[model samples]
Target: MKQRLGAALAWLEDRTGLVGIVRTVMQHPVPPGATWWYVFGSATLLAFLVQVVTGVVLGSMYVPAPDDAYRSLEFITNDAPAGRLVRGMHAWTATAMIVLIGIHALQVFLFGSYKYPREVNWMTGVLLLAFTLAMAFTGQILRFDNNGVWSTIVLVKMTSYVPVIGDDLGRFFLAGDVVNASTLSHFFTFHVFVIPGLIFAIIGIHLYLVIRNGISEPPEAGRPVDPATYRAWYHDYLRREGVPFWPDAIWRDALFGVLLVVGLLVLAGVIGPPEVGAPPSPANLDTNPRPDWYFIWLFAALALLPPGIEFYFLILGSGLFFIGLFILPLLANRGERSWKMRPWAVGIVCVIVTGVGALTVYGLQAPWSPDFATQPLSAEVVGATTGPVANGAQLFHEKGCHYCHRIAGSGGQRGPDLTTIGDKLSENELIWRIANGGVNMPSFAGTLTQHELREIVAFLQSRRSAPAPAQNVPTVR
Candidate 1:
């Protein structure tokens, strides 16, 4: 039996040369010091494989039509066999892939691995990052829920901020002048087919480059890259101390990849998928749509940017950022590779990570959005139980004023807290502001009656701090 099996294997190898190819790849030499930092790239590839597997399962069950997409998702979550777990795995793995790819990019940048012959590798990585994010955005819209619908609209509107081709771009994304039946199908095609195809192609090229150029060695403080001599030096260096990739360096990548997969599975089983929101409804005025966590930083930035320069910042800023990423190796590919000698690189990474982290936290709180779920202030908190003050307090919530303005710490922080407005503004001033409105506040002139206006003003006027105790004065001798 052993002789027969060996003969069959030899026959296959002779016909295809498959054994030699595998042996060559597995026995490829890499820098001996290439440690756990090198594992992230392979780990990211593992995460992407998980995404592909789970996404295929989901795509098989999800309906691409707008009318049925939400219902299909509900069915998959509640009724299908192990559907929820698979869906959770898909979502969590997408998150993991983004995080891993980001870390891998940062590692390469910090190590100066993008220098010399590896410039194409970095450029391919940038394309993968862009495509990964594009996949995420398109996937969010496939939920077809209230938040998803509104998010699509918001994205379309933002696209409309571009100069000459803005409207055309918006129309193209929507598949028409407005989001309709075709919109879901368009995004579904992008999420499941188009973006994934692009990613797969780029990933193939990236891997080819890695094998062709060889992995970069761990940076030494005194070593600086010189393009003219880098290839020869790298080959000689590898010849001196390099180790086979399979049994030596590949073990760390394999171990980390397994752990990452197990962690994602545990998370998926424990947490399940994000809850599906209400079905899409244009009439749902109270909806406060937000992007998923990965995109919240950009959302916060757009919300916080000054109105005058927002358009320029959105268009020019994003374009320049991506352009800069592609041209980075060209700018300074021969610099000192060690972080110890590149303080500016460390500072740039620190600033970017800090800024994104802070923005994400702020976006989660979303102080700028109206709090539609805010309850009416209780009579005790309002300091009134009857008459115009009490009635006005009730009206405050009924009229949706509490949604944006905080009074007794029970409302949103979008507008100014009006807890002590009476102390700052006169009755006339309050009336004018409320009647005509200012800035983000809407006009209540036609909405409120004269009696209601007076009642609200009376309620505002009653909100004052307690008077301070009288102080004793010193007498002159």
Candidate 2:
């Protein structure tokens, strides 16, 4: 045992020291003309650093309980000074990381960087992508809003499409039938710990490969060199390609990184974190409970398909997608490197992203229903007079009916306003009109009693024709 330990110590001494290690790996050359493209991996890694730091800050303030989750988020967004800024940066920069990593992968693949000598890099990259997506999914669920629960329900149903283990997979996803605090707990663990750990491992391996292979296709590299025989570390290595990490590439990446950071800060400051919805309500019944804009397209697509298809569309479609992603790379010829040579492959990717973008945009602006605007206050016609109109007035504003419609310069402009409505009709005619709305308004007669209907008409009349009440107008000095 002592002899073996001594031998191992001797091997370690040979390669472990600072100078010896440096002198060792410089054996391989960097890509001859290293450009912005070469630094993609570095940028990706830097973005990861940002994510980890930002995530830690977020976890510190966020609560995990049912009652506290929404209120805590409200505090972070509305009360905390820079909380919104931090949240936006965390969210939007995650988007930037995905985009940067994807482009970096494309650049690597396009330049033949994935050749035999650098296959390790390819493997590590694929794993990193999987980790990145996993982190995204888990982080999204951590929001714990109406959309979050709905997204989880929809995704679990989709997961149930797994062939032999379908039911088991669904149960595992739900951790039971419902997404309670436990579901958030599951997501928090995977997002904050497990997935991040796996990603770090993959990223470390990827960096090792880059250093091991010397940035793949340095312009000077012609014939492949033996990996075991690579040499020339500290002395010639730094002397040749040792660009100081700070000023050399740091300026470019740091500039963009700062831009990303500042942009997120501005957005967060301006918009704040997304408004916390009414606490996780099972009956909120937001028909189009779409995820954030990033995943809106997927949700819209899922919604667009025939409801009859059930989960089959999700399963078969996703299965076919991964099948293509993994197997399609093999079709490339040995020497194919240029993007032009892979027209079909590139086209397919473009189409997928474009379709997703288009669908997301469409869903955001799509009309949910005809009766969607702020519903006018309902009142009853009683004693030949509209009932207490202000009661209906209070309900109108209380229900947020103004979001999609206008009323006496008070609401949104999407639907008609009631500024001059009383000029056109008498009380009885107005009642008839209210009962049968034109295009967007819903009939209140069914939903409101005669007294309630009268109150709403009085409210509308008060807005359109009545003199300005002394209480409403402030006197000027």
| Candidate 1, 51-114: lDDT as tens digits | 9999999989999987689888889898999999999899899899899999999999999999
For residues 356-438, what per-residue lDDT tens digits would candidate 2 score against the true structure?
77888887876644234444443332112323655657655554445545664546553456666656566776676454332
Pick out the ten consecutive residues of candidate 2 with the lowest summed lDDT. Answer: 378-387
Report the error of model 2 at residue 229, Å. 16
Candidate with maximal TM-score? 1
TM-score of each: 0.78, 0.64
Q: Which regions of candidate 2 deviate over 4 angstroms? A: 1-29, 218-255, 282-288, 327-333, 369-477
Q: Which ten residues in a row have the lowest lDDT in candidate 1?
A: 468-477
